[model samples]
Target chain A: MAAPMKSVGSKLSVERPAFTTTSFQKKTRSKLVSIPGTRPSVQNGQLIVSTGVTSLDYLLGGGLAVGTLLLIEEDRYDSYSRMILKYFLAEGVVCRHELFVAAVQESPDDILQELPAPILDDIAIHKPVEQHGLPCGPQDSLDSMKIAWRYQNLPKVQSALASSSRFGHYYDVSKTMEPEIRQAANCHRFYFPEHPTQSSPTQSPMLESYSALLKSLQEVIHKGGFDGAAPMTKSRNILRIGLHSLGSALWGDDLCCRDNPRHSHALTTFLYGLRALLRSSLSVAVVTLPSHLIQNRALMGSITRLCDNAISLESFKGSERETNPLYKDYHGLLHVRQVPHLNCLVSELPDRKDLAFKLKRKQFSIERLHLPPDLSETVSRVSRGELAGAAMPGSACGSSTSGNKHLDF
Target chain B: MFTELNSILNITPDNFKQGEFVLISDRHTDGSFLIHHFLSFYLRARCKVCFLGLVQSFSHYCAVSQRLGVSLVQAKEKGQLIFLEGLKESLSVLIPKEPNTGSQALDFLRDPSAGLRSLYEFVRASVSHTGGVEGVEGVEGGVEEWGPPVLLVDDLSVLLSLGVSVGAALDFSHYCRATVCSQLQGSMVMLVRCEAEEEEDDGDEEGPERLLKGLTHQCSLTLQVQGLPTGYCRDIHGQVEVCWRNRHGNGQQMQKKLFQYKVHDKSASFFARGTSSAVL
Candidate 1:
């Protein structure tokens, strides 16, 4: 059966010798799997790579799979989602993968310059958690002595989420990635306002900016020799695409402008075409869409369905949650809208849905959402009892603050 | 081999569901598996099948079908299967090699107002032609001896994504029904994506919602696959709401049934609601 397929494939192509030999080598060698940054997922055996943020990768079932698109719904201010896009690109640079960055309002170069520098030393990588424990230094030991004698023998509750074998690196948000490190990787930039193929009056239903983006992505995939159908070159590499702030009015799309936008299918068509392009190539895209502004909820739903994975960032910058004492420890909530089920019937659902992310001084991390334990006596007895009951399993209430299990509780 | 699904769908070896329309719709969950089931089911039943695969490549369908105990390549070789690969054709439509020459099935890409006339023509030609390869052995030398043709569209919602208007899509399916179902006494199965959120907001209906509504009204059976309202799970993948319209008795009585399903690598199992092992 396999022999007949090989012969048929050879007969169809004029370059039969090269095609046959290359395909034979591809089957035997499977050399692409040996690429530096990629690893086959144990769950379904798909090639996966980091999303730059290790905690986020844990939420996304190892990482973004090759040839799949990850849709990031932008927060109200667009700050946190843009940070994620930068983390994705910065990870590509560290891994030496080729980069394709596109944006409408911001220049791709500007986005690249603001990427957080990756933390290198292992000691510094663990410093953020240790620093959180520094303020209670002198009193934590005393508080431990004051607890019941039987409970004193209990194991310390580690609060930090212990990540598995480190496939992704930690990034320090305060430091910008060095220009020298950023320039090490090959990068393609597409700023819509400055693109040469500005606005061609095409009969295609896709918006000019969107079609142009798709065409450019196609050229990058085919000409760069990332297409699976094309014969392999000397070396194979992954292409990381970072598209920022799509579906905003700046991209000539009106999905966010009105309740009944004129071009309702424009964004979805672009995504459809883009997904088709990505499926047959060695590329992964991280697209950040301003879904909050899009009035048509149904359109947003369709867009989410088109992409492989969809996540939305609901930051509490101006919302009532920002001022709530219960949520004081976190800056935003991360919703796992959709996870891809590729080559299998079931997807790898995240362990929990109530996940939150915070931007500490040195690092940004995502953690299972939890509220602080109420310590004051001013609270009523019934609510306090309830709070204690809810927080008992995972709480660092009496000041030990050391839970290293990533999914503690 | 999806025996459970077959029983729930009321499909039997001899019951070919002639002159009927089956609409498979999914929201926030993958419904392409239903397409695969119908594709392999018709081929196994010895019916002539025309599959309009607008989402994936030919090799993808062939690979999935091979696992389901059918050979699509062999089926195509024997003239039992007619496959239209929309992914490959759409690329050509986007970047036309020559000005006016291309696949007519995707003319809506080049001219949005042109609609799906050429696509419907393609389907009409495939199912009506009877002389190529004998789909069924001639028992009494009569055209009726041949097995009924089945038109399976992996998805019809993509046409809307490719700029084809909702009305054009409905018209395409309508004509397909007229030829494949009404005239030839064959069955037509189409897959569409419609998010359930549309029901909450009754103010304005979008393209997909309207297309789904239009197809649901015409179809004899409508199977809606949707994600769990609570979220993803380990045991049960999703639930299917099967609505059967009784065209014979007043055409207004609809039989609605719901079953939870879990899809495996090669086959899927259907169980009563809350009967999954995880629930136990």
Candidate 2:
């Protein structure tokens, strides 16, 4: 037997034995199915892993719906972003499906560095940089016009398609990358209307005009050329998305926040607008905010809702050496110390014997921060502390469990 | 026996064999990597392993599989749990695909978003083998323990890891099925904003430096070696202790090992310090 365990959608069909359920009514099946060299276990289900970034992937029990989003954030720096982008653009990401990444703030290069280490090569980063409003020529201009028309006209087609019954979270965010969006934003059709075989290269003035610009760039390989082969892909996971420094970008929209609805409202409007925009487009979205910039509680609540995974950035108190020199200060950088009740920080050295005695401070042992390994454990820990860092432990509603159970669906 | 899985999941195996495996994980971040590495390791030895939750990127999976030692399997469809038990009943042979021998660097070009599709193919082909004997079982989501066909591998080189997500230590607890208590448990999972313009070299950390920890784990031990054939594998054997200050002004130390280095060069195998060996 051969099985392609691709997405959450597929697992819905595996035969699970019917058993008395005390609470959750998740799908169950019972049967003996065999794949190439192994047997499926009816006992234990797959394990779930949280990227530890925060507020991201919690909905799918810590990832995209095995068939959907990965919720990878973006990078402010170009190289890092490229690294992030490459993780979704290159090869081996998936041998069976088309890969795509959409970035509004970061360019392709900006997304590359988002990976833990930058050797990732199989994903496709859908960038807006390439969609600089179609190509440039008569046919190209016409194509751009059509794309614009399509963008506006998409609502109607999508209204029907959306109504055709594919209900999920990614409906909105993915629309930007939908076939309809591409049909309206065709890069090839706008610029290359006349068959390159029918007309002389010189005859197309529009194409010729951009020739100088094209000269510097590596010409795309024409068909029939010995093309690069795609590497074998082995991806059996979620589509990760990262919204790196979105608040900073919106704040950077202008010189100062003076005239723009105050800093709080600006943040409020920014988050609400994007949140509405992405509800259907992406499976998951994580927007990180620098703690220093958190000026309002109301706006913070709305902004935090944008991501299912929420990690507060911990401020770096010591020299830059205390930090990974690669990236700048981020709230996500906080080293979360796991406890049994709620999440707590190994912060402050227990507020006792240090600072005055520098020598003793250097010897601070990491062993004192005894915590449960999992975040859920922290909920138990938090039940004891009840501080800002503590998490609510084991409540029917707040039972220290933060993961969304609906993802199993 | 796999019959134990009958109450937990929707799928189960028809028969129990010496070479089959069933893996399960709690909602920790590195759970996926653990399952992948375990599967790849077992599969290479002609054993089969099924993964439930989502895992890491293709490159990470490939790197982990190659490094951890498992038969390479990537399924991309949903409801695989539904069809899983059926696929395990008839398959009697382990088929080796082409050596995916891809480098970690190549992963940058790979599309992690497309991982689901491949996973789908892996699931579909396994259960629906037209004329195969079918007796596999599936574990419905969230019945944590007591769920199908189970493989009890004697050796687990690396325990379950949290994939850069918070609460990785807790995940490790579930992976090891044991608790890890630490005093100063600090971890580094997120990416840093390294300014490319800085002329600092990648390996030029003169003073103290933080390394990536095995996410979602508590370590009884963590250590690091300064040099290997490559430059001394950092976090070798995942034996580095992380120390941090707590609210009471007391220094704490957590016994968590973030990463372990596999001595690539066998000639250098004789070079051992504090029990450094191959990852497998």
Candidate 3:
């Protein structure tokens, strides 16, 4: 049905089905309805799957839509983002969905082996309930008399982990998922070093690894019966594609090297093609890009625009924020850059922009960032204002308002 | 089609002249709606259209246009539309098939250095065909007898992403303008993605910035879509800025107009600045 299909050979034309009936079926009668781990979004009726982190799913307005790509802009050290990717795979394994793991520097097997074990629903519900309980007793009653008393009846903001319905699972970061559990689902690996590269004399700027990855992904989608074009003989399953640390020098993209990278569009082009592939199939991909190293901010912006949903992790690794007592409870900041606006005019925006994630002993959780209240009676208003200024640099009015209150006193 | 949008942009069939180049650009927002508007606009004007849709699939455009009271399938069957699906073609070319020596429009997929001459030729062949002379629809209104051939590209930025240099992409569009616009008394419209300058940027022009500046200088009219400076809102989706440039002798006079727009499923509503219900 494609225009160029006429001029090209029959082999190329095999991809485009004669009847473009697959898309119309996508809206209401999608075969994806039968797939495990997917649910129709109440907002727009688009099929969605969790991103492993329930709070992240809530931030994205239900979950990542089927046939959509979720881009995770890596933190400075790439530690937290890696953990998030593992959560994604772990959730897939638990849901019996097939997994396609592609990586350049690290082996896909190693990454899969490190997936956090999913905690039992009862145990997952126990800890957060206690945490919520401890804050609601005499301490809250005593604190309610403070100047922020107006917010007392505003319905305690739901904790990120307090999911009303059991749609997603919480994982224990300390334990590796059992081998038997991990092996239950099908897993495809694309280790770049092992894949043979086609060294053409023409020397296209697009790296051989990218084309290899795309070919491998396309093959898996078609062969695994994920493409909706063909009727299913066997039961359908979702393919969870996890691509780790793309656009780095290891992938042969020069975007991270110089101000004006020669192959600036290489990563973006690959993403565009990759998105096209995902759109026509029963697949959901979570790609983690090392955006911190990318030299051109504008290129990063374009990359963000191309994806359906994008969130960037800014970890306080070596920065001053790490040592700042104000941010001691949080390990990093999670910036929700773009949320998918599928089948609708407006996307679901995160209720609060100031979000922080903490890496606890056995779990990783994202929570609303609230500055620890300055409760010392001996401390002066001037020092409190300075502390507020130091803690939240983005909000200058926090300190100025405190200063104004001091003047009135 | 979008009658309100058409009137806002003053897009009358006769208003567009031969050799006229219209550049549609967007920053910090999705501007594909403008491309859709122009697509059905030309089709409704009885103009033969050749669409090089790189961002989306044929079904997507077809489904959207269907809501706007136009059947892209019928148009394609009647030879009134020429659609080049870039997404499908790019993926197929990425597959390592037998290396043929033929210079197809997608030769750049096999060879990045290869220019877009073959793609340009494809457009020319499709638009230049004189279907009126044939007995098929010769008596009725054929493509040649209907209106001038118009070339529309959903986006040109993807060319840069596909490894084709900015200069080659410009040359490709330049040639299309010559053959389709100047020679055939038709018009050309291209959509380009331009990145907004960040605070830290020192205004050094290169890459997308340079390409946008180059295209802006050559095009007779520019339509820019930008997000609300204050941020997102419920009623107003984004703003559209239309600039008309008329060159006379040694100098050029420019007229600029701005409108706030909100897109719906079937149609889009465009209003003057400060007129949106949210703002009011």
Query: Which candidate's DockQ is highest?
Result: 3
**Strongest candidate by lDDT:** 1
Each candidate's number of clashing pairs is 10, 266, 0
Candidate 3 local lDDT, residue A195: 86
Candidate achieving higher TM-score, 1 or 3: 1
Higher DockQ: candidate 1 or 2?
Answer: 1
Best-performing candidate as measured by TM-score: 1
Q: List the DockQ of the predictions in order.
A: 0.37, 0.01, 0.41
Stronger candidate by DockQ (1 vs 3): 3
Evaluated on the second chain alone, the candidates' TM-scores are 0.92, 0.25, 0.90
Candidate 1 structure quality by residue, lDDT tens digits, A248-295: 999998889899888887888788777777777788999999998987
lDDT of 2 by residue, B139-218 (tens): 46431211122222211211111011123322322332221112111111111111112234535321011112231123
Tell me the tens digit of each residue's lDDT in model 3 across B1-280.
Answer: 6788768666675565566788998887777777777788888877788999877777668756765777788777666788988777767666646666333667776667778878888888888876474113533554345578889998787777777778988888888888887889888889988775534454665556667778898888898888889776657778999898987535667789998888876688989889987668
On residues B1-280, what C-alpha lDDT tens digit does candidate 1 reach at each position? 3667788877875675689899999986788888888888888887888999887767667767777888999888667788898876777667544666667877777778888888888898889987444443334653332378899998788777667888889888989888999999999999998764747656766678899999988899989999878876767789999988898888578789998888887888887889998878
Q: Mind sharing the TM-score for model 3?
A: 0.83
Query: Which stretches of model 1 miss by more than 4 angstroms?
Result: A1-32, A122-163, A198-201, A378-409, B13-15, B58-63, B71-79, B97-102, B134-147, B200-204, B229-234, B249-253
Residue B67 miss distance in model 2 (angstroms)? 42
Which parts of model 3 are misplaced by more than 4 Å?
A1-32, A120-153, A159-166, A196-202, A260-265, A325-329, A341-354, A360-363, A367-381, A389-409, B12-19, B100-103, B131-145, B198-204, B232-235, B248-251
